[model samples]
Target: MSWVLGNLDVIGGHAGAHLLQALPAIVLAFVLALPVAKLAGRLGVLRGGISTAAALMYAIPSLPLFIVLPIVLGTSIRSMVNVIVALTLYGLALMVPAAIDAFRSVDGDVLRAATAQGYGPVARFWAVELPLAGPVLLAGLRVVVVSTVSLVTVGGVLGVPSLGMLFVDGFQRGITAEILAGIVLTAAIALALDGLLVLAGRALMPWASAGKAPAEPSPAGAPDPAAAAAGGAA
Candidate 1:
């Protein structure tokens, strides 16, 4: 514990590096995903292809992705950039499918109503579709964030002193405290990011859960007029 407190700099640096490494991937992944989702929704082509590719990308060994980048891009390999690129590729692959699912989950009626009200594609997306889709999108993002938090440590194998690198170092040097620190930090970051995603989702789509279960019909064919009238009429 004393050692942990003493090495605040190391812990802080690792945390910052991890966040730096991940933020780009998360944002880029979502941005890339949104359009691919829209395109998939519009064209209805190769969705399985895109998702399978993402799953394949996920299955890919991260070390190899890092290795190929330096070989192909020729060794100007900034760990930050490599991590982001690797993350983005994996991110896009996973997220596009999730995004499409979220978008599809929105009420069809809401979209149709928006369409009837002279909302164009862009307007409708901004005004209606996105609003309804927010909860699902956030749920997927939370999954990605949690996954990325753990997977990101793999980036350290490439020489990024990312959070994972700490654990790697701890293992290499047989430092139990450092290894524990890394695990604890990673878990904390995952929880924090997931919480933020949930808050954002609630803010974006407050109405999605507003009408949880509709009122049941009266047992009689006609609602009781007295009861209905008292309750502001059926």
Candidate 2:
């Protein structure tokens, strides 16, 4: 506790740097995932290939990717950009499959109804398809937010400024308090961001908060008593 109090400024700075690296990756991954998922939905032949590739991409160890990306992009191995890009790829790999499932989960009947109402492709997607997919997408987004925040700590191993630095430094000095502080702080940041995403989702999707209305019985296929009586009179 004394150590935390003494280095409050340092801790705060690291946390800020942590957020700066993480948040952008989360947003970029989501944006990229949507279009790729949409493409995969349209190109049935390509869906399997895309899923396989995303899985392979994610299976690549982060530390090695971090080392290799610098060569590909010509950035310093320790640069913040390198970390952010690596994190984005990891987030993207997770988000793509989840997003594909989200879009696929939308009912085809609803889309047909939207088309019957004279909705163009763009209008139907923006109004019906995207809104229907929102809940699942929100679930995936929450996962990405938590994962990204936690992953930022890995950058500290490479001498990038983040809470993970405490872990490295504490291990060398054998200060259990510092290590615990790092773990606790990293978890708190992840939870805080996740909570914010939940709030944002609720605000954007008020209908999801209101419990689903009871399913009304369908009138189709049931004989109409009035029609039967009219036929008998005729």
Best by TM-score: 2
Candidate 2, overall lDDT?
Answer: 0.89
Q: Whole-model Cα lDDT per candidate?
A: 0.81, 0.89
Q: What is the TM-score of each candidate against the true structure?
A: 0.88, 0.89
Candidate 2 ranges with C-alpha deviation above 4 Å: 214-234
Q: What tens-digit string does per-residue lDDT give for candidate 1 at 87-182?
A: 888787678778988888988887898899899988998888877777777877877788777778888766677888788888899888888999
By lDDT, the best candidate is 2
What are the runs in model 1 whose C-alpha is more than 4 Å off?
213-234
**Model 1 misses residue 57 by how many Å?**
1.7
Residue pairs with backbone overlap in model 2: none
10 residues in a row with least lDDT, candidate 1: 70-79
Give a tens-digit lDDT track for model 2, residues 1-234: 888899899889988889889989999999999999999999998998897788688888888888889999999987999989999999988899889989999999999999999999999999999999999999988899888888888888898888888898889999888899899999999999899989999999999889875555344755466676778999
What pairs collide in candidate 1? none
